[model samples]
Target: MIPSLIRMARSRTYAEAINLLNTCQSNAATIEAIRKSGGRMNDYAIVEMNDYLRRIGYVPDDLNKLNVVHITGTKGKGSTSAFTERLLRTHMTGRIADVGLYTSPHLCAVRERIRINGEPLSEEDFARYFFEVWERLEGNTKTIYPHTPQFPIYFRLLTLLAFHTFISLGVSATVLEVGIGGTYDSTNIVPKPVITGITSLGLDHVAVLGNTIQDIARNKGGIYKAGVPALSVKQDQEEATRVLAECAEEARTSSYEVVPMIPETALGLRGAHQRINASLAVALARGFLRAQGKEGMDDALPRSFVAPLAGTKWPGRCQRVEQGKTTWLLDGAHTTESLTSCGEWAWGEGNKPGVLIFNCSGGRAGQMLLTALLEAGARTSSSELVELGKRFEAVIFCTNVTYTDGHFSSDLTSHAIDPNDLSQLATQNQLRDAWLELVPGYDPKQAHVVASIQHAVDLVRGMEGEHEVLVAGSLHLVGGVMEVASLQGSLGMV
Candidate 1:
């Protein structure tokens, strides 16, 4: 035990821990193994996640002490989680001592995934807790099962670490965001939460979550737990609404309500779509407070809620960074509906043609995402931004690889993408070709396929005039932009 403790305390820096975390990401082999497992990958996912929790020295019931507010959705889930955390931290002063937030697909740093009091865990803390969980898994590998590989995958391990960290820190409330679909996501191992929420639903991760909109709704609604209140914003499709209602009943939620959009008020996060997320957050916070026996939880918006809402900051969504002559508009909108919202916000915010830096995952339909963006821009009533042909000065497609050296920053490493696709620049080339076909009279010369994100930034930097640059499609791409352009300062990162 002394030797094991010493090994855990060995020279494990934050960087080294992050590199270890990167190794667990789902690569081709992981996916192929799941495919050969003979059913949906998610079939026994939560069961395995539960076992992982126990191996890490906790059970599903142990998470209940954190008083979690589990949130899942296709689009605005992260924003909703952010708003909920801020609301609890600010409004529930004496009752809720501390608030913890855990969200996914972090923009710049992995530390951003777990936060307390709205600040990410310090690097020292992140590493200390990361390896504690790591050693737990490593120590038990031979005992668990000899046939199956040990150590949970990237997201699962992170989830386990998050649970351990939150429990150890004694946070009073936890705003947990689902990494994928609600039902089988690693985060869903929590047997019960104080409340659960579903933000506006859309079709995303169809290959893994489900195929149709109803399937997507059912998967997201899986977060609804028996005896817990489930809240959602009005979905666009009635079929989705029906399916979600069914899920709530099936889960035996105490009550399932479709929350109305919050009154138009100042919001820290930009984009009109954020209002939906904010509204759901309001309901979840109120319900959780009531469950905690806090009084003065009125139905109407509280005076204390206003400031936190306006002050809330979820970086990388509807974010703008002004660097010299270039104004950068960045949003991680990969889905079609989200791209439409992104386009509308871009045109409404700056009614002028700009350079578009875009790339999507290999599996996504690039043309559809591009169409949603371009058509939304064309529909913008602003006369200056009305012409579809004039909407973009140039379009660039580049891999999410951070630097021109063909390497990823350790914190930004992703193994989910295909190695062959990355080597061939397949996704970028497809996006470039899609742009040419979509825009009539678009000069092929104006559409470029670059090998690295730094190349795209270099092109924008060398442009002759003041340019507005819109970076969208992938959060990984946005993080690469933030790294290459050194725009972390804009997001108030050190």
Candidate 2:
């Protein structure tokens, strides 16, 4: 029954499979089946996804048979991946050069994670690939050790699915993004990558990754395979230089050669930080070309790659939109450092009076971010900073920007107060008063909490104002803002 369901799901029948599961009676065997065969975090190790190539009877006879550029970092991984894919497609012609890109935390659709030449995988493709992988794992439940349905994790399944999809599709080159820390990431199964790229390191996911910069760097740098070329765009030159040096030394001694592929100038993305990202991409591309013995094959490589870097556009990173007299700028700067940098870049060296629509999840350093934004000259004396007290503005307008699980949606809005501020607003009246006071001019008749992010964007669009609508909060909000603006035909204006 489980095998059939898996097959059905793989054949673009996900809805049926899900419905069947819900209606089926709970049984130890059924649960065991899901536990054993379903996706798991460490399943990559148990399943040994790399071995599938032989089992499926497809073998690459040469080292140059497949080109892989592995990119991992704290930020800019998505943009770098997109830029690299676009550049390669534009330059590498006539070979049906398919570029496989896998990014994390989709903006609106899960299909957005996997792309071929800048286009996302379609819904049918996702369903088809998902079930195909599941079918392959069917009847081999015993092969999985200490199997637990919840243990292997969904992300592991996605990783294997991506690899299988890329290979089956005969992608010439695949750009894989490390889901988390690189060394143990499932994508690490790829053998002899053309280049390994790293983006700027920051303090994030502290509980899982590490508490300090070096600790995080060590984990991220784990993806640097021995003997493979590498590139990085770390801003703290000394820290980046030191970390890369250490990684290089370790890799060299272990038979892996590491090379510096920093960019010489800024690419298309905004902020000085992006210049580093472009550099990393450039370094990786150069190494890839050299490894393929295509170094001098095209004189356009240098110019073509560099030219696109400057004009390369990525949504939610200081994206701007104008509606009538009002200008909307969306940025997903959740951390203090990122917020400070973004505010500085947006407002420039001088202070500007602006309206800031801000909100944050529980664990983020919101207070610190607020302080940084204020110091960076973001707040106007008249601008209101409405912390989501008890009754936050009910309708949260989301622009198809990036978001996280910790972000507030209708499900968690009631409990979405800042963890640090939860103690202060214990009383109902206090919370209500705080919420009401935050909105500046509260009109309950016009107030309603919205479920969809697009609704909030529409509301903003209908408003009439010359003031810049600075959307500074989470990536989810930024995405929502962009999607709404795009719908209104104002996206490219940014």
Candidate 3:
């Protein structure tokens, strides 16, 4: 049953594979087919994994041969994954083979989710593997999961695809970023990884992971397998340490290492948070090498591999661009916590006021961000700061971030708030009105709305001023700005 499904899945084109899967609405049959072809995860109890593997003809034999690095957290997962992948590439040898990197929420393309040494999977490769796994399942069986039964989720299938692709490609090491909560996340299929790392924990994905830092930390910590070396960034140190310690004990963890993060690093990527992320990646890589009996592997890996990260290019995180005489900063700080931190960072002590261009999705923590910026601006100058917040001389409200339909589209007219209008209202009223006005379609419940980020960029480009432009909200938003800037030759053109 599994072999036939594999053949069928492999025979289709990339588009066909996607269409077939989409047609099934991700039913149990599709999932079962995926499982038969080698899909496994921690959500299934130990007994379930063993049973599924046995029934599906998966031996879990490759666990010993593979070097797996699992990274989980609310934020900085991508940066950490990229950093770790790059460092490993610099050190490891043997044909200098491929490294598997799996990141979630692909910005532009589905293939972006799975890359081998920074290149997306070839179309033929993706199609071949899709069928290989599909044919391996028993009688093309499908199982109905409780929750939304609308086809197996795209991420689930993509996760399986990544695993199979990594194996087939003979990748020596695979760095996986957990899609959502770690415990039940699809990527938890790997029995034991060489090392597990967690980036900073925040209050996102509240519905699935739970609210509060500790709750989310516990969920992310689920990626830590028994006896596997685990490293984490500096978080709510006391609470995080305590929770991780408890988890380590329960999992019979071999060694638990905490990265001693320096607040300041020479890394081009700024923000105190990035320092912690870099430290976590460095410590995890060190532990991974040490476990592989490559301890003190200096010559094998370049000193620059673990050197203070510089020239790191992560889109949407304080990315700076210059157009003409204006300095345009782009960041995708969506959550309140991230936005507030970014706001404070932007309005650093003795910094010059500039034009602020921003937008937010429905139910986004925009109010908190506006408040933070206002407070930061207020501290700098009683009148000028207030005026800066009010006038926003070059403010443009546009959308091109994460949309409900999983596509980039924004409606500027909807939920548009003029900075000038905001300035006149009392501080508290301004915040309230801004929050209400920014609500897309004046509907807080609907997550779908449109805002064109390009429009905002055009507005900025058209403006005549020596002012710096600050673009913040979502990574998707930042990516748009970068894309536009790149096309316009405006990146660092100042």
By TM-score, the best candidate is 1
Model 3 scores worst on lDDT over the 10 consecutive residues at: 409-418
**lDDT against true structure, model 1:** 0.82
Q: CA lDDT, every prediction?
A: 0.82, 0.55, 0.60
Clashes of each: 0, 30, 27
Per-residue lDDT, model 2, residue 123, is: 61
The digit string of per-residue lDDT tens for model 2 on 245-355 reads: 687667652323233444365565666556556666666666666665765534423765766666566556666655566666667776666676676656652324244
Can you tell me which runs of candidate 1 are displaced by over 4 Å?
Answer: 1-9, 28-40, 94-97, 142-147, 204-210, 351-353, 381-386, 492-494
Q: lDDT score, residue 110, model 3?
A: 51
For residues 1-494, could you state the per-residue lDDT of candidate 1 as single tens digits?
Answer: 34644453466789878877876788855655442332236566777888788787887889999999999988899889888998988855654338888998887889889888888888999999999888887777653344345777888889898999999988999999987777778888788899999988775445433367876788788889999999988998899899999999999999999987777889888888888899998888889888989777786576668888998888888888788898899999988888988878888865454799999877678988888888887776444322564557788999988889888888888777688998999989988877877776778888889988999999998889999899999998998899888887655311
Candidate 3 matches the true fold with a TM-score of 0.72
Query: Per-residue lDDT tens digits of candidate 3, residues 422-460?
Result: 234233243345644543233332111224555556566
Ranking by TM-score: 1, 3, 2
State which candidate, 1 or 3, has the greater lDDT.
1
Relative to the true structure, candidate 2 has a C-alpha RMSD (angstroms) of 7.9
